[model samples]
Target: MRTREEQQSDPYPTTVEIHCLNQFLMEDWDEEWDRISEELEEQDIPVPEGYYEIQKQILDLHQDMSVVEILESEEDDDGEMWYTIIDVEEQKIHPGMPRYALMFADKPYSTDIFLDNVFRHDMRVPDSLFPQTWKNRQAAKYQNM
Candidate 1:
């Protein structure tokens, strides 16, 4: 586990290694975005470019979600760290689990740490549970950058 100070000082500051199982749900955005976009297009509704590329997707557990497990975290050929997460039940249901997805550390995801631990917190990741001091520090750090 990386300390909060270390995470804050990191140049990239987009990688995180979670303990094991963490609950998360997609926040502020629908997981069925593509399908929704298609429906909107069919209805002649114009979709904004902001929703085009998927980046910094929020992850907070939905009420319907059972369990989310962090299988592993590894960097890709491009040196981008990607964490493999899977739905436990989904994997059991389908061998080729469609719910399995790669999550970037830069993205938003909910964790129980804020309610329990703070020394290992990462301010770069947005979460309402994070202390205000850490949030302010993160903001200032980015402003200077």
Candidate 2:
């Protein structure tokens, strides 16, 4: 897992690479987004454009309205991280999930800003989770099915 500090070293400050696992419900997406936005605002975090693009890609892929998960690395255990699953249709985050991270990979922004936003919220991606490359592979596999 890449540390927030390392990600900040890049030219882009606020960009994240997300692995979209599944589709989420549109109805709940707004409510969940509101909650996420509120949390960021409270912490003074600004997500880059790339983050939104990743989210848009997921949304486009899953038009039926589904839920998505964001996995973060755990601080205490390098092997484990946290997962925040949001139900787009309900527009609310699933219980026992962490807050959403801003700046999806496809979005336009710098890594520095992305790391800044993540650090501002004290967030981390879990090492146990799949990398973006793996996720893309899985997505492609399913596309042919």
Return the lDDT, model 2, position 59.
Answer: 53
Flag regions of model 1 displaced more than 4 Å: 1-35, 52-65, 69-86, 89-145
- Relative to the true structure, candidate 2 reaches a TM of 0.25
Candidate 1 lDDT (Cα, 0 to 1): 0.43
Give lDDT tens digits, candidate 1, residues 1-145.
2223444655334334322222333432344655777899899987667544332233222223444344445555776554545455555321111222323232235454434545774458557778765676588877786
Against the true structure, what is each candidate's TM-score? 0.27, 0.25
**Residue-level lDDT tens digits of model 2 in 1-145:** 3433444564333333443333222246557878998999899998877987686556555423233333233433444345444444444554333223222344445545655536555578675686765675578877788
**Candidate 2 residue 20 C-alpha distance from true site, Å:** 17
Q: Give the backbone clash total of model 2.
A: 38
How far in Å is the alpha carbon of 103 misplaced in model 1? 5.6
Model 2 Cα RMSD, Å? 21.0
